[model samples]
Target chain A: MQYDFEEILETIKMTEIEHFDIRTVTLGISLRDCVDRNIEVTKQKIYDKILKYGKNHVKYASQIERQYGIKIANKRVSITPASIPFDSFKLDEFVEVARVLDKAAAEIGIDYLAGYSALVQKGMTNGERELIKSIPIALSETQRVCSSINVASTKAGINMDAVLMMSDVIKETAERTKDKDSIGCAKLVVFCNVPEDNPFVAGAFHGVSEPEVVLNVGISGPGVVLDAIKSAGKIDLQQLAEVIKKTVFKITRAGELIGREVASKHGIPFGIVDISLAPTPAPGDSIGDILKAMGVEDVGAPGTTAALAMLNDSVKKAGLMASSSVGGMSGAFIPVSEDQAMIDAVERGNLSLEKLEAMTSVCSVGLDMIAIPGDTPSTTIAGIIADECAIGIINDKTTSARLIPAYGKKLGDYIDYGGLLGKAPIMDVRNLSSNNFVGRGGRIPAPVRSLTN
Target chain B: MFISYFGKLKGKKVKLSESEIRAIAMQAINELGDNANPELVKEVVEKAIKNSEYVPIPETQSQTTGRVILTSFGLNHPGIVSNVTKVLSDANCDITDLSQKLMGDFYTMIIMLDISNSPKDLSEIQNDLNVVAEKMKIKVYLQHEDLFRFMHRV
Candidate 1:
């Protein structure tokens, strides 16, 4: 036999019992050429382009899934940032684009279509300003359109003006969709140094430099990593890291193969395989569970950051060795709602907002899928976004805030969207005011680290 | 022939046989006539290659033998192997290897099959096996060999 019996059994066990699966196979279609002078013509072009390239996205993904017997969780799409091509549009016109995106997503049979976005890391254009203003209405009105705003980067510094506007946008999005526990906020992400090739939704966008169409994948297998760690009980940190790397390497290889296969099926170029160990709401598929298995008492324990740093590092090292096309946010995601154990920690008071922020410093993204009190002021939200941006710029890594201020919901309450978004306990946010600091709207000059040249 | 010739030329390390190069040169001469300088011959050859239909290699064709691992398990009972193999035989699948283990009334069997020659695809075969599994009260899984090879073999 070419493969050992135990090896075959292990592969089967990972898929069947360990919750190992490809998190998403996101098809990135560029809409740069879809722009037109007339809003109606532009909408038609956008719709036609998406349908032409993406009509078979779900069908092809399912066929590949059946052939490999590995489940692909989500078949989604990302487009070029709307502000880039449709920069001449007004606020209402941008909302119309979002509606078309939502309709195309439904027609193509996908749950989410991202890249209803603006990249204002350095500054904003009049169109970008209008697009940012339209996000709340676009999100409130559409079902599948996910929006993101990039407000900071290492080279361009933090766009405090964009950050403040996004803060208000998040608040308004929550308020407008209050009927559904502010679910609109769940689909909005505020990013710092956002990856152009990120396959993960609520933050994914087809970078300007990308080809006309591409397929990027996000791999998820925290359950597999957790099992490997539990089985390697009593080992030293070095050996434990080896276990994680081995597990992550195999999964990354599998992920790359699946990504290539899906792209080949689409007859488009294969982008990158993001090795982020994105957690789901399932029981064993929690990054927090992996952290606990690594000897943390809970997610907020003193040694939690060290454990996460080691795990995130091992994942990247293994992923680099496994595949050369690794891009996107290739680290462990600590979203409060998506991971069951993380949610439990928040509900039990073992995990707090501050600890999560600290964890984000070493991980892929920041303050993800967290539900806070409705009355948490926009200035405080801006303060939170600024803090996350500071960490990202200083470290020169990608960070984001997907803070959902569930309208009228306070601490001790829960915002349960169920399914993949899962549920998050309304975390406590300090009442400290940042009205004076964020009130001064200007770009934070690029940090000294940005002077790499 | 023209595509392979053009592909080799594009690499700029021409390893064509004498006859092949002569054929290309003759064609270039025929096309360029009195204008057949080195650069003109090159341009004519390039245009001919571009105009020819270039068929891309089919990506779905597996580089390795199209083998699949089918694993089935259930309470130990008679006729499980016979019934399952019946489906494979019906699909014209070649069972290359088989192993079975019984651990106190529970039976697990792993079968290696070459399905490249089968008329039905993997999904169709799975659907057939699923019916047998449901009737016999067992669990069966069919997965491509590449998945195992990629994960376990470096």
Candidate 2:
């Protein structure tokens, strides 16, 4: 195809000015066939498949990044949820398998490999139970491995049992890595209706239904969108949304092009384009910056949810228009720790944990990368997850909570994840107890679409 | 017939901007029908060269081999280019292209370098570049070509 000179220049300008980047190129490798009665055999199979499929993925990603003059920010590997592959393994064996995944990822220079995960939305299988139990040690001991648990879905209703269990797991994970300000909690995510082919961590895992190997791309362009909004200067809400949609179309188109090329190069089927406006710690690249550009002085002010709802829908609309294979969690990500502006807002008391939770109902993921007080009860954590999950269940949307109980750190303290994870201000959580509410642990029952809330 | 062809393309199959397609169309028209005198061409070329130091007209698209684009962002200051390029030249890396512009106080410069013949890997060279960036109180991003293509174009 003939290249457009202006478009080429526009790209150079975007890269130079805006922090536009292909956020991640994640290769989802399925390990369903790795299951064996002998856990050792299963572990070997997992390692062998990862090494075989992942050896040249990062090498190719780097080469392509250079060849195109675009930044491929991260190269990752997502495997089928480990729980499904080792239903017979004990807790320590699950830890051992997580070690194998972690070691293989490090060997291949993968930024993060996600799969120390389980799907227990309805109820927990023995395998899922063991994996959930093993998560505290598995995540605390590993460097590059991320774990996610799905405990609720619209179709299957809310799994209150799994929600309570995952809440306890989060606390355990925080306590085990307390010295590093609960860094392990940062790597662990609890989800409701998680996307099967998401490329972003710490919620990415190859779904049971996905192909054996697939390449999924997550495109990030919050800075680009925010720049567009700023240049258009105080337009009506409709026009503002139009600006976001057009910008996202351009971003998603670029993502589709790169994703297909990468997939073709690897001889693997291409998966969806997750057009999430993922932010870094850079000055201009922030979701809070985008919100402020939309005239919200504070990110979590009263109209924030409405603004977020519009932003999220506009992103999805443009993404679908730009790519035929748009899926995953394609919306505005409001992860508190990753966004510098959000962290600033929280520190200044303009944003709070409750507001963040409310915003998640309208955005992509749920209460993400939020650091609550060290003394916050595990039941409170479960209560928060249950609330987010209830929202996801009713709306038939994906929601997640990656709350870090900055162990021994209070609301005023900050935990520095460093690099892309950014710094998180420990925001105050409501002291209202929900232990009895979560204690009635069954399912929250499916939403009645006929009776909309 | 040629005019009609373009007219139909306006409503139907033309994906490129009219100007871009027009450039190609004009070139085709000249190549297919026009005749030019070699003597006149040579005389004009020689006259232009005699008037100034011989600067070769680069091909429409410059060929790139193992090119890395490094962008430096910071408050505008003197000698930014000279100092940064000095580092590259000292490392024996060839600067294939350089462009810079100032918008307000922020000076952004993009340098495209040929690193195929470099003695050190890009990562090691980035460390050296980082030192210069740190000293200048600027952030320098070294990126590959895909970043530009994947961000800007479909």
Candidate 3:
């Protein structure tokens, strides 16, 4: 039979797809081995561990990137919770470790450093309690160190008892560092069965079960999927979904290939693939395209709920179908500055923190890259993070918040974090409000409803 | 035939719109099959009508439906249609079943899909699959008869 081969070719050509590559492969290294009776020996061991393990990480990551045609964006390290070594009176050990990690990160070309953290759930351990008391002085001395204090968990239920104490700890930490610009307060998170292989920070403490040397891949592909979905116009909803599924499959294949090769070359086991839609203030690839595709003119409008639900569903379905092993908060992100569309939405008065919270309900990570007023109280910021984490705990999904309270910046003002933090316009907060409820520092007890299950 | 409606012949001329003329042609065509030729075509024409505003109704007739054949190589790297059709021909499976999707090293193909009359179960047809798979070092999985239909609902 005679046939139109060209028309058939055109149909196959319609499947246009691309990927943004995995942005970061963070290795969570515990610094417990760095402790010693002698102060200088402790500092040297910290330096030695970072220098030894981090030496070949970036080199091997680059080689894998070239072989698989996938870009490996950042190769960094997050150590064991730094609060353990801070049980001293002077806080000297904390500053020493921070300086060592900063130097090691610079030498290895890793952009981010994390794991300056404290855990105070159900009540702080003696070491943890002391570390929490000295957060302000230690944070001020470190150049690149970022920290977090876990004050609650779903498994252990609400630690309202501990959270109440944490309120004062957070307040004192926030106040003591008022004069220092670099020392920012990001010390609040809720861990709901935290993963050992999670590479994203500032909550990336080396979990107990994880290996000393394992390759954790953080895959980012929002731009590629958004582009394909945008091109599939006038199609039925089911057909649109199929196109997205195919796109995600192809992108994930690229990530898996790269991850396996990275693991092989480094002689480290291949970790999980985090199929998250991480953004970087770039044009065309922003999460806003997804919202717009869902028929929302502005991202944070009343229709935002339906819009985000559709976006997250498609992303999760496509990612799951694409790869066998998927981990991390593998969903579409709505960070304000990291995404260009989100940044523009906030500046244009089309997006607000409340609307963002509504959108984050459907996203993997909650309230990420949000910039609130500098004068915003630590309790209020903690409350925002708490609300976001509560959604994660209840839903049994991974969620986190990374809010930047730009010092000396008020409502309508903007701060440029220059590179990866991008730049964000200060968003308005609810006025005439006191977080007196939050200030009554103690963990909110986990819901009694969960006990039945 | 100068037939006209009795009340409509009030002035100098009477005219039918293009649609009305086409309607007459269509009626003649339907009544006489393909034999309605030049004379029927001429009778359908009328003089220009006022405004001549008319919406033409589309012809309603049954036409042949198009078919898509999904063909797969299953196990080996065969030259598209030639080798895939050869397998069907050998099995006497006819051209009814076909879809080809190359996932990784595995060459999978499904044929439009009427295999009910075949003398073999799907497993029997998949026996010679080893020969192709060993040649390519890839396993071939088959979805025969009602399997594809049962699988993809959307």
Indicate which candidate wins on DockQ.
Answer: 1
Candidate 3 ranges with C-alpha deviation above 4 Å? A1-19, A84-90, A133-140, A160-194, A448-453, B1-154
Question: Per-residue lDDT tens digits of candidate 1, residues B1-154?
Answer: 3322335445432234455556667888788788768778778766654554444343344224669999888798899999999999999999999988898999988999999899998999999999999999998999988898888887
DockQ, candidate no. 3: 0.01
Error in Å for residue A357 of model 2 = 1.4
- A98 Cα displacement, candidate 3 (Å): 1.6
Cα lDDT computed for each candidate against the true fold: 0.92, 0.83, 0.61
- Give the CA lDDT, 0 to 100, for residue A160 in model 2: 92
Q: Please give each candidate's TM-score.
A: 0.91, 0.77, 0.67
* TM-score for chain B of all predictions: 0.63, 0.55, 0.37
lDDT of 2 by residue, B1-154 (tens): 1221222321332234445445654554465455546555444434433443322322222123456677777899887888888878878888877777788998767777878788865666777888998898887777555445544555
Q: How is the predicted docking of candidate 1 categorized under the CAPRI scheme?
A: acceptable
Residue-wise C-alpha lDDT for candidate 1, range A164-276, written one tens digit per residue: 99999999999999999999999999999999999999899999999999999999999999999999989999999999999999999999999998998887889999999
Q: What TM-score, to 2 decimal places, does chain A of model 2 have?
A: 0.98
Q: Rank the candidates by TM-score, best first.
A: 1, 2, 3
